[model samples]
Target chain A: MDVSFLFGQFLGGLTTAMFLFLIASGLSLVFGVMRVLNFAHGSFYMIGAYLAWQAMQWLEPTLHRFWLAALVAALGVALLGAVIERVLLRHLYGREELYQLLFTYALVLILGDAAKAIWGTQQLSVSRPPLLAGGLDILGTTLPTYNLFIMLIGPAIAVAAWLLLTRSNAGRLVRAAALDREMLGALGANVGAIYTGMFVVSSFLAGLAGALVTPIQSIVPGMDVEIIVEAFIVVVIGGLGSFWGTFWGSVIYGQVLSFGILVFPSFSIFSVFALMAVILIVRPWGLFGRPIR
Target chain B: MSRCRILAAACLAACLAPFAAGAESTIKIGFPMPLSGPAAVYGAPVTKGAEMAVQEINAHGGVLGHKLELLERDSKASADEAVRLARELIIKDNVDFLVGTLTSAEAPAVSTIAKENRIVFIAPTSKSVQLTSPKNLHPYLFRLASNTDIEGHSAASIIAGWKEVKRVAIIAPDYAYGRDAVAAFIGYLKKARPDIQIVDQQWPKLGQSDFTPFITAQMGTHPDAIFCDVYGGDFVTFAKQAGPLGYFKAVNNRLVDGGEVGTTDEAQALGADYPYGIWSDAYDPVIWAGDEPPEHKAFIEHLKAFTHEKYGSGWAIMGYSAIVALTDAIKKANSTDSDKVSKSLLGLTFDTPVGKRTFNAKTHETEMGEFWGQMVKGEHYPFAIISNPKYLAVGPFTD
Candidate 1:
């Protein structure tokens, strides 16, 4: 009930918001351009964390090597996404949405099992970077330095994403593809290449988010299911294709969860569903999403 | 040797092969445990231990002129699956005995089927109090592993002895095992320290990934010690999330936990994130080393080699012990009849990898307790080590 406690809770919520935004933005981007509902997005995130840890271990495992390994691991997932887009998703684009959904869901099961086979069920933890290992005093409460880094990364990526969408020529093509892919194809645009690029970029974002949180989270099998469920909620709450929508949605959700735990400890999980239900009732397509054709 | 006669003779030989194999006589055990789920980390090692024990026993010329055969099935850590497999193992395989269930949820279902069919059931690692309690107790059901009551008391005894501890908090999974573990710990804790005040309690749903809310809530109450019963993947998540919030380092507020938290596997996995100086109970190799029987040392070595240095947790020991006890009961009865073996299992004493264990006649629960110690990184262990180890006896209430 004190000011400092409230401030601390708000910061904790911000940390959650940052990670949610980092993950949900990628999912929203994919849905916007490709019209494919990727249920296996969480698998990419999980693999990013595992591969990052593996990469760091293979390297010196020093604090200096961690950030570089994380970047490379995320790139690895991006490369994988590109291959998947070329080999599998390209063929499925002409099919019904339900079939696409089923395919992605199948991928979820296959990827989850593959991860278990590779990593085993034992939980793996990544050590905090030595520089950000401890806490810093903010007012009367202490906050972890690593948490602050994650919070900053969220908005920094948001700005970078905004610029990429608004300023870049590829961004214009992406917006056009979201509106009408047939017209863009008729206009002599390589629609296939654009879709692949979008998928790769989105997967990279997801992988980056996963790698960023690895230092604080214990990477384990089945984590993909846990995260993907939450990511779906975030994307749904935000408009599916809206960038700023995801940012706001994550922030709102994070605050609600943080405060809900304090006010209603048992019902905190229900709070998220309640908010989503209300949004669905009022704006079925989400706050910023366009009506489905 | 006409072609027609040779073909007929081949057919006859093939038909009689099954009968001859049946005549040879083999003791079969239906081993159902979580082999392909989140619980497999614990269950797989147990399966390995049971396999090794059976192999060793069979190599020494079997149990009473019958080769030991294990019919292993994946229970998937579900009660429904366990019950289904129990029926299949019995009706389909026609096994002589049932053993090896991982979780408490699977324990009762398997035991019920075992009782109804008059088959002997031995649970290697299910530790919920309800499994062995009189309410669910059946004549054919026996447990070789220590239950929650013993573990809780062992944890409480250690916590009570901590000189600076005055207030306590509790956190566990929101299920049967978690609730019972906390209750048992609190009951013994209150008895030990009558003046101790319980400040807070948190029961996060099992498999909860985010512990920030729970951590913040627990920190608000400001207890001197927190007793946690969360294990497996959830434990790792809690440790990672809570460590940053200074949950482990808050002055005079130590953390006490039951089962598998500070073991070598966890310590190696967590690396620098492992909470040093926290008190926990583990079935650890370091605890087994130094001064123990030669057989215990040999069992440890064998398990390490067999697992290829992958698993050597207490679950392995439990699995190894279950087979030892079952074989011992059969040896004592000197027969393969389920009813006779079940009767012999009552008040049966047997040598295990850990030590000599006896099943109490009334409860059908073993005298297995827990090994309690403080987590430390020392020269003796490459990973997390239990520096000071002590074994507590399973009291009357454990069953």
Candidate 2:
């Protein structure tokens, strides 16, 4: 009820929103350009987390750099995404969207099992970098420094993505491809290369989100399912391929979930679905999503 | 015979091998557990425990002149899958006994099928008090783990001993297990220390990756102690987020959590960040360090060698106990008939790695024990170990 309490809740919501945005944005970007809903995006995120944990084990002693490990993990997932897109996803582009969905869904199962086989069935965590291990006092509330760092990452990524999509020649090609892939191909835009790039970037975002969250949340095998569900919720609410839509959708979702718990502790889990149902009823395409081409 | 006919006959023979083996007077127990997924942390060890027990029983010339056979199935931690697997095990596999449904829901779902089909069901690590409550009790259903009441009271009894503690905050997942655990703890805590006031109650949704809201909300109330039931990955998240937020550092505030938070897995998950001095409870504690019965020692050692680890998971002990209870019940009845085994299991005594346990005939619930101790940095163990473990018996409060 008080200012401090409200401020605390807002911060919590914002922190949650940041991670949601990072994951959903990648999903939305891939869906926009490729028109393929990657169910394995969450698995990519999970793989990212596991990769970071493994990297930390090797690097922490020698490099002592959490940031470097996170970067390496994200890039590693990008490479994996590139390989998947080249070998599997590229071959199925002209097929029915259902085939694409099933393919990615299979990846979720395979990758999840792979992670289990590699990491074993135990929750693992990475420590917060020494510089950001504690909290910062703001308006008499102790906000975790790591949370603030995560919160800042969302906007930084948003800005970077905006620049990449709008300001660069590569961005133009990607957008052109998203708008009309057949035309882009006819115009000699090398659409295949653009698709591969988009997938890599998308996977990098998912992986970055996973690596960033390692210090805050326990990394576990089934975590992919938990996060992917929420990411889908964000993607659905934001509109399938709209960039800005994802940003606002994540904000709405995060705030609703955080504040909803305080008001309706027993029903907070349902609030997201309720909101989704309402949104679907009014706007089936989502808030920022364009009608299917 | 023609070449095609020869190949077909060989394929037919390979397909029927398991059925032929089953016909050879073996008692089959269907073991359904979450061998994968998030719950696998608990389920995997539990499966190991059941397998260990089966091996030991078989080594000892088997039960009732029948070689014990374990047919393992992955429940995937879904209640529907557990029920489906139970049906397959019962109708298709023709298993005589059902063992190891890990979660609170999976246990009852499979138990209902077992009850209706008149097959003996043994739950290894189900902690929900409702499973063995009078309303849910049936002739076919039996559990060999400490129910929520036992753990809650055990936790409460220890909290009551802290004379300096006054106000307590409760944080648990918003589910049957969590709500029931908090309720049982409060019921017993109120009885033990009437003066203590519950200031805040925070129920986060299960698998919630972030606990900042709950932690911050609970911290605002400024209770002297916090009682948390968040376990596994969620517990690790809560500890990591709350540890740096000064939730455990405030003056005169202590933290006590259920057993899952104190396991070697949790400790290993958190590493140096694992908070010390917090009182924690476990289903299996490291209490047999100096002197343990040879059977208990052997069980622990074999499980460690089998699991290839030093720390013995409580779920492993519970899993072992479940089979031990089932085999002992069958021995007592001198028959594998469901009715006879069920009747014999009532008030049946069995020796487990934990200690001697008795199944109450009325509740169909066994009086197993849990160990309570403080988490401290151990020289001999990884992460933190539960120090000064004292065994607490199940029953009394929930009954």
Candidate 3:
């Protein structure tokens, strides 16, 4: 009830919001440009965590090993995304929306099984680097240094992504493609290549989020499904395909969950869905999303 | 004409070979468990334990001259899937007995199937009381693991001994298992220590990756101790996230966890991040410094060889005990008939690696207790081991 306690809760919510933003942003981008709802995005995130853990095992124990492992995981997932897009997804883009949705759903099952086969169903964990292993006491509440790092990185990624999508030539082409693929294609732009590129970038973000979350969460089977549901909710609440909408949506969700626990401890699970339903009824296209043509 | 008659005889022998082989003396037990996914952390080890038990039993001239064979199938930790597998194992595979299922949700459903088929089913590790409650209890269904009430009471008794502790908070996965355990703990704790204040309770859904808000919210309550029931990977995550935030230190490191987080697997998984000094329980412990029983020592040796792991898991003992109990029942009844075996299983006294366990005839539940102790660093292993471990018998509480 006190100001300090409220402030602490807010900070905690912010940390969760940042984590959600990382995963949802990629989902939003993929939907925005390619109109393909990638259900395997969470699988990519899970693989990222697993890869990071494996990489950490192979790498020498050092202060910078955590960051290096995370980079490797993100890149690995991005490469995987590229191959999936090229080999399987490219064929389905021309088909009905149902086919695309089913394809991604199939990927979810396959990737989930694949992860289990590779990881052998044991729960794995990655330790935080020594530099980020401590805590920072703020307003009489101790917050994890790793959580603080995530908070900072989330916004930084948002800014970087915004600059890329709005300021750069590649960004302009991607935006144009999202608006009108046929028009962009008529303008002699490589539409297929742009779609692939967007998918890779989205996958990279998801992978990065997964690798970063390893220090806090135990990497286990079914984590892919757990995270995908939340990420999907975030995207849906923010209006699918709206990058900034995802950012704000995550913020709203994180706070609702954090404070909702305080107010209604037993009903916190329903709070997220209730908020989503309200948002849909009030603003069907999402807060920042435009109406579909 | 003579050559054709000889060929016809040979063909008839080949066609009848399968039925003749099917009648060969072997007792088939259906083992349905989560072999893949997150639940496999417990399921895989449990299956290994059952396999070890089956091997040991078969080596000793079999159970009443019938070699025991396990028909293992992946239940995938879903109740529907477990029910489906149970039917298939009963109808198609024609298994004589059933012994598997790792979760509360799956066990009760499978119990119904066992009831309908009139096959003896021994639940290895599902701790929900609903599995063997009065309304649901049947002649064929039996539970090996201690129910939620026993587990909760065990935690309560442990906390009651801490004279300085007053304000207590609870955090558990928001479901029947968690709710039941917490309710039992509070009900017992209030009777034992009336002065103790129940400060706050947080019900995080199972598989929730984030524990920050819950952690911070509980910390705000300023409780002297926390009773946590989060288990497996979720517990690992909770500890990792809570450690850096000084949540353990703030409560003076007095958290009593009742989900078998004291097991070697959990300790090793969490490693240094494992919250030391937290009171927890495990069904079996591989390391028993001065009080190691010969049977336990031998079992650990076999388990190490079987699983190719340095330390035997506490979870494995549940599966090992179930098989041992089934084989013992079969020996007592001197028959593979479900009715006979189920009758024999009642008031059945069996030897486990930990010690002797008995199934109460009235409840159809095993009097299985766990080794409760505070976790602390030991010189022998990298992870924390139970310090001053005490095996709390469920008899006193259950009766």
State which candidate has the highest DockQ.
Answer: 3
The collision pairs in model 3 are: none
| Ranking of predictions according to TM-score | 3, 2, 1
Question: Candidate 2, residue A110: CA error in Å?
Answer: 1.6
**C-alpha DockQ for predicted model 2:** 0.65
Question: How many backbone clashes does every candidate have?
Answer: 1, 1, 0
lDDT of 3 at A84: 95
What DockQ does each prediction reach against the true complex? 0.46, 0.65, 0.75
Candidate 3, residues B295-355, lDDT tens digits: the string is 9999999999998988878788888989999999999999999999999999999999878
Which segments of candidate 2 are over 4 A away from where they belong? A291-293, B1-16, B251-253, B287-295, B394-399
lDDT (C-alpha) at residue A236 in model 1 = 81
Interface RMSD of each: 1.8, 1.5, 1.0
Tens digits of per-residue lDDT, candidate 2, A1-293, equal: 68887888888788888888988889999998899999999999999999999999887364358889899999999999999999999999999999999999999999999999999898899988888987889987888888888888898888899998999999999999988899989988799999999999999999988998899899988999899899888888988889988998999998888777777665657777889999999998999988874
lDDT by residue (tens digit), candidate 3, A223-272: 99898899888888888898898999899889999999998987657888
**What TM-score, over all chains together, does every model reach?**
0.92, 0.94, 0.96
- Model 3 docking category: medium
Q: What's model 3's lDDT at B331?
A: 91
- Displacement of residue B236 (Cα, Å) in model 1 is 2.1
CA RMSD per model (angstroms): 3.7, 2.6, 3.2
